[model samples]
Target: MRSVNNHCDLYDFSIWGNEDVSSGKGAKDENFPVGSLLISRKLRPHVQAYYNFARVIDDIADSEMLSSEEKVKRLNGMQAVLCDDVPAPDRADVQAARYLRNSLLETGVSFDTATDLLIAFRQDAVKNRYETFAELLEYCRYSANPVGHYLLDLHKENADIRPAADALCTSLQILNHLQDCRADLIRLDRCYIPLDMLRAENVDVQAVKDEGTISGLRNVFDYILDYIDDLNREAEQLIRLTSNRRLRMESSVILTLACSLTEHLRKEDPLATRVKLNYKDAIKAVLYACPHILR
Candidate 1:
């Protein structure tokens, strides 16, 4: 499990070579929308390569073993290598830089978005708590929005859908933060729950970390769950924004999963519960996501 402090990036590439559940070749992004995969098969490798590079920083940001100074030093070196400002320091950064550079050359994925991710990763080295939701959203601009922006470029889609995509991406990022709050606090001594919100509810962050879901904190979790519902609604616009059926259907599936997961969190306390799709709902999510073009 990754720490809460590491929520700065969504690139889930494994530092460990992964097994592709699809072809059994290499690893795949666990959170990647299945519909997107089916529709965007040609784009996956380039996307995965970028993710693999992103994971190199993930390895650094989430390392419990390294001190902040060491982590910052290594991240700076990785950044220098990635930007071609310096030589590759080691194998992982070299591979990441090589793949990411190749991806920039071959695909329309934005280099600026990737650089935004680097800035977010750098923040994780030095910062911990966000004072408010607005602050957190500002952070998400760098950490989460870039993934959506990259995807938009990959699809050759214009900015018409970028707003909805950004909402979906940020919602996913927040969902992850809420889901991992307790564990993150325990393992990383970090809490992503907005301090103001927690104080308003008279819910101390440490109490949730130590005691799981207390009744006092239920309101905060419920509010977040409601926000997720709004995000899901906002994302429904994404499916209708483009005429590309593949992209539309892909958005449908991703939004469906988001709605289902948010509904799951409403019923299950994220502080104490780990919610995943049951078999029936998982199948339904996919089926419901498929449009006539795909069917």
Candidate 2:
């Protein structure tokens, strides 16, 4: 019942510090690879650090136990720690910010790439419904695009490649939204699907709670998938624009996975069951990455 407008003490990290609220999910728990073998071993630590930081903030936003006000307060505390405005508490989540702060200092990557994610997490703490696809993309710009920016900076890849990187990251974000649409709606009462599209198709937001996909909902899914197709097409340039061989291979593999997942979403009903990449998809991603190995 806490009000977000109230002047909550940002330093009161102790309220939720009694217990960890992290989903306990890690890089491997993600749908895509993270700091995998394709990345240079020397830089892997930085990638892991960034991932840990992102994971912590994302968990704060998604926690059901914390009120929206508490979530925002904790997130602000973490951001303050990341920017060196305050000392990190003993809490694991707050400590994650300190770890990434050190990593950024070591690597010389801009802190903006990391701070931008907080913008999306803050939005997640309060905002649930996306009114349009453009709005969702704006969310992804902060939530997903910063991930690409971090990797590109980490690898010293050209800034020009960001367009393609953004395409891939945004595609992946939408894919996840599609895959988790039902769970997101049922558990959090959040819907990432564009409300306008749902209305255009005559589908209500609650339709996601059904055991199976309705015809109207299916139309909405296809509408989103078709946009993902365009994104994948643009994302193909990522593999080509990347100068580092390992990064190119990694981009190729992820691009393949994104396309494969898009196909899965297109053919499968996410509401009926989980639609995700399988072992066959993994094999395909590796095979696709092979050609880029010697590049």
- For each candidate in turn, the TM-score is 0.84, 0.95
Top candidate when judged by TM-score against the true structure: 2
In candidate 2, how many clashes are counted? Answer: 0
Clashes of 1: 2
**Candidate 1 lDDT by residue in tens digits, 20-58:** 112122233444453246567787777777677667676
Candidate 1, superposed: residue stretches over 4 Å from native: 1-29, 34-36, 292-295
Query: After superposition on all CA atoms, what RMSD does each candidate show versus the true structure?
Result: 6.9, 3.4
Model 2: how far residue 149 lies from native, Å: 0.4
lDDT (10s digit) by residue, model 2, range 1-295: 0122332455565745677679999876778999999999999999999999999999999998888888887887777778754654587877898899899988989898988999899999999999999999999999999999999999998898899999999999999999999999898888999999999988889999898999999999998899999999999999888999998998999999999999999889899998989999999999999988777
Best by lDDT: 2
For model 2, the local distance difference test gives: 0.88
